[model samples]
Target: MAGETAPLGPARVCRLPPPGGAEERVTELCTALLSGFQRYEQRIRARQYMDGLLRTQGRKSIANIATTLGAPGDEHRLRHFVSRSHWAVETVRQALTAFLEESGPASAWVALPVSIPKGGEHTVGVSRHLSPDRSRVVNGQRALGVWYASERVVAPVSWRLELSDDPPTAGRSTGGGPAQEGVPAPQDCLRELLDDVRRWGTPGPPVLMDGRGEDESGRLAALFAGQVPAAARINGWTPLAGGHRTVHGRQAVAALDALSPTLRTHRRGRDGSPDRRPVATATATVRLAGTGNRSRQENRRLTLLGVWHEARREPGELWLTNMDESAADSLLSSARLLHAVGDGWRTRGAAVGLRDYEGRSLHGWHRHMTLASGAYVMSAISSSSDQARSSGRSP
Candidate 1:
């Protein structure tokens, strides 16, 4: 449905807490989410850890959490809970999905690969990579997350770690071996994750990726062929022509940079400021490279949505989608939903110390990230619930 949103059902209401009873509500939430733990002690430990993690003043290190909660054995027990506990992460995964379903239906799925810079080499899967934030090379571990997003919330539905072929220093091992044994490439991890998402049903929204994954359109298109529609940002100068004339061949940057501003739009300013800018958009049918069929080099026509900002002279942003112009425009034009994915990352980092994981084991990395995702989902739900109640609407 282009330019249209399905009407939401009666909003689900979160049971309110009594006056001065906010902690009880949070505790209740924690218990429900931690019920996935197989052992009763595991459940208790998980709850205690979450409570302190949220209340802890600084980085969510094991020592800080242990000291803040005054738990026995300081960081030892807490460390065991995350790095050595036998609780199955899959159980928590299912619980999180169930809670998200109860919150509301999702409008889209965003796949973001997060890069966490690490100072030590002992961290599992830590490898040298070009850090997008740092603008230079850095040692880091990369994790890919597929998040479900609606107008009110965005939460991860699936996650995978990118493994490098290089062997880890002593005491460090790859989190999990790839299917084939040797270290798996990042693309391999993405393919497997996308396949897993395909099996996850309900609120099945289209998937969106950033410029990095968009460059691998061939494999991505083949993987999702005729099942789920996909959209991605492409660099300018991607061999698009305005007309069928053979001489019209030109890069996306050349084609879009020449157009004048045709639309004006406003975006919320950072730091509570207001900002406005002149913007323009144009739609065209372009043959994106790598979208050709394998049987032969047959090009598949895709709707190309181009957005240009007067300030950024280069290609502002180019979106390639299988939907018609109206549908593609409706889905990606505002671009706010895209930015919300980054917001999810920021919230996790500030509130939960998303980058402070201390374990070096493969399972430990997965376990920590899984719990972090749960914490983030709950926070989003609570925030939206408060907003709904304040507005005199159920949520």
Candidate 2:
């Protein structure tokens, strides 16, 4: 039962300076995001909560944050503001999306799957899920993060929590029903995220994600067909047909294996020396297994890209893309953006308490994530500004 315990109670209050530099810029960002709260007090409380998140160290539980802000008595008020307030999370997300758009042009829209390990089942959407590496099982909340990524800056603007069908049997009541019924599939959740981006009227950038299994690849290929440009890694054994070379049917690995490397490149090693592992890339025109009722030839056509290492006999990586101009370097560049999202989440995201919320309500989770995302954006912007100024360039 040690790892199954909930977070601890509040501690004594302690005074800490606000999150270092860029206070004024972060304040401006908070003002833009919290504008939807009609009450002035609500807006102020939201600002305080963000400040607490930014300033708190270690596990950013509400109690710890409250203590760090030297307002231990306001803990309950902050809790209620996050869990029980009627603030619209979507409005803040839309505003954040607008803010990111105005900041600069995004290179790619990356979908990042975040798995937060939790100790208790009472948290909303907490369930047993496989770790990202699939090495072991973890009890946690699974959330899909939509990130707006560019060459210099990356920030998460929206999030969707994956709710479990089983109800928690701890201190929470479910009225003898599941915690939430008819939970959407992963693809559906992504579609909903895309819908939000579309509704926000932002430019549609190429979508990127790690290789999905066969079933998901098929569904995703159909979803992106004629809808938007996308580049998703697919499993090597995924079936495909109808290449430009009149191939009848073959697995992705086989299709890519038949082609020679069209491009080759090298990268710097960890110690600043050139890495010995040479990378090669190749491409073939192919189509996913299922294409539903679309007559346009271009809609059904997709490029099958294979990335190989000098040491491997077969292609080491396989990807599928529907972009109009699928250059090898362009697709490779898009794939690199996924790393930016990962790095941002691990560093700035953790620092801002992205996974530190201990509440159990759906609304509370959304509110917390929205604010945490704002915190990440502020930190990223601040860091970018610092780097630009140090490099003698305008931010």
Candidate 3:
């Protein structure tokens, strides 16, 4: 097996000694989990990069990884493997989806966000835009990504880079090549990404979003109608409940602000003590915007839950969701999910070089994100399995 002719040019392969403990587990993971890459050479290259990403302390750029692995000569080869290769990223994503179905938590929320920070404009999709937090303006790649959260797990499953309006004009010039065609607007991109999940036969969960816009017209409600329920943070000024109750005519935040003070209805505080802050909840059916080609507004009955803290002097939090009257329960779950997603982002960036890519091509971005996501899930599953083993139980 050491000298077999392989798909990648004329490189000779060597078999490693049989493993015993951690090495064996990692080797098995590299082989079994990444089986979607059919070609042996592709698998080898992928594992190599993943290993480097896992082992290197910081900045998992191709050159850094190549140097760390003492294979400086393979830098160009690995770069080509990521940017110019024809490997199917979709297959790996499908495998991820399947794996989640087998050992994952019950679907709670599908939180999607549409931006990642970048330093320069040369890379594909890099443009000037408001940050996702909307705290300031920044230059970055516009990306639409889907993250799934259950009781115990949160991980990114799909991503699309929003191509800038001014894609590189020239063909394969020195800089990062031209941007790929067929990039959709951010809203449309979310639908496309969700459609991919549908194609995988995955069931829909509540679409949780923050900071889309004033949902007075309920455009998002119409968009996700009949597919899955949705939860979002609407602009404070959006109308609700036909102007009847306190929550009807006033801005969403103001309505919640005027409610009588009550203790928080959700879980205990981070320190395991009961929260004493005032909270409020309400429900209403708002009108949604048109769907497809129709210009007419559609009616979508939704629930609104709000919590106000006297110390804050404003509505501390608000939610608009189409879940049952128990929208408060879903809000609690979705809030935990939102927190988990933030933690996962930090972990991915630290453990697997989520933001360390130096490649500039469209394919490169997708390939990097796919591998990074796989690495993240693999680490999570492996850790979970080890814990179960220590406890003498099956995972």
Candidate 4:
């Protein structure tokens, strides 16, 4: 709610002229997103649903959207299209990935975990889970969102719902039921997302993952060993094979504690201020232990990175990377980009109804998310165009 803007409403929808207005842009985006749809009516329905998402005032329920757009007898039709439609969600996502690649190449791929709260018991993948910040337990749907991110923009391109181990409900075939057997670990979900990205034929970019509270650095690094470069936040207690005097394995924090810290300054501020913050950094060559059953000779060599703020007594953050020659500044920049993606999700994502779905089926939730992602991309591109116009340059 902090970064939200007033709704556009029906009045604004009515005032936009044809050929070059925001409505026209929405039409173009929908056409591109759903080009694989076989039926013309499906495309039209998708456009209408997306329009409602962008212009409707309050919650983006099907009934609310239909009523806000002044479309009589459309609530049922839209619900059917979302819940029981035969179209493939993967097709729409592929088109979206293509559109984004053509718009501008992304600098990195990010895996973002989100928690959507629910009041009822029947929604797909609904269960008690930790909040995004891991503050407290809440009843919600846990989802992994894969994003293509750059300094200028960030948008979710694919999503995966984490199924709960709760017993299957009677007659439910779509989601949170017998269709999926058990819940996958967060690292498994991230691996599946990366596989999807690779299958889309997009350029492999360095992956940035949030491993703040978990000690999955070895497993996460193994995911990108021979595929693409990666940097993941590592727990201080993660075991390492090198960077210590003893032959025994040592913790990441202990390895850094044995080394000298290098002083560095960060120029980019979170609030866009020019002030610089001096940071102490250190690095050591190490190998992550317990990745797999590989022998010591087969284990991949990794760089253990440690950073300490002037105010903190110990290292504030630890990271593990497969990029052996990566500089400390570059890895820190990637960390900043990770924060930017999170901010974009909290603000732009909320505005486009990222968590407003009211469906009970797995396919329905995915369809709604696909449309919401399109709306987010369109809004981001439109805002960028407006800024370019105001600055007397090309969009």
User: What's the candidate order when arranged by decreasing TM-score?
Assistant: 4, 2, 3, 1
Summed backbone clashes in each candidate are 6, 0, 0, 0
* Runs in model 2 lying further than 4 Å from the true structure: 1-21, 119-121, 133-135, 167-181, 213-215, 218-226, 239-251, 257-278, 290-299, 385-395
What TM-score would each prediction reach against the true structure? Answer: 0.75, 0.79, 0.75, 0.80
Rate residue 60 of model 2 by lDDT: 79
Q: Rate the local accuracy (lDDT) of all candidates.
A: 0.58, 0.65, 0.58, 0.66
Which lDDT tens digits does candidate 2 get at residues 33-72? 9887788888988888887887888887888888999999
Lowest lDDT sum, 10 consecutive residues, model 2, at 1-10
Decoy 1 TM-score against native: 0.75
Question: How do all the candidates rank in terms of lDDT, highest first?
Answer: 4, 2, 1, 3
Model 1 root mean square deviation, Cα atoms? 7.4
TM-score of model 2 relative to the true fold? Answer: 0.79
Model 3 ranges with Cα > 4 A deviation:
1-29, 119-121, 169-181, 212-226, 237-250, 253-278, 289-297, 309-313, 382-395
Q: Which residue pairs collide, candidate 1?
A: 12-395, 175-362, 237-251, 237-252, 237-253, 238-252
| Model 4 C-alpha lDDT per residue in residues 165-200, reported as the tens digit of each score | 762431243421113336566666677778777777
Which pairs of residues collide in model 2?
none
Candidate 1 lDDT at 316 equals 58
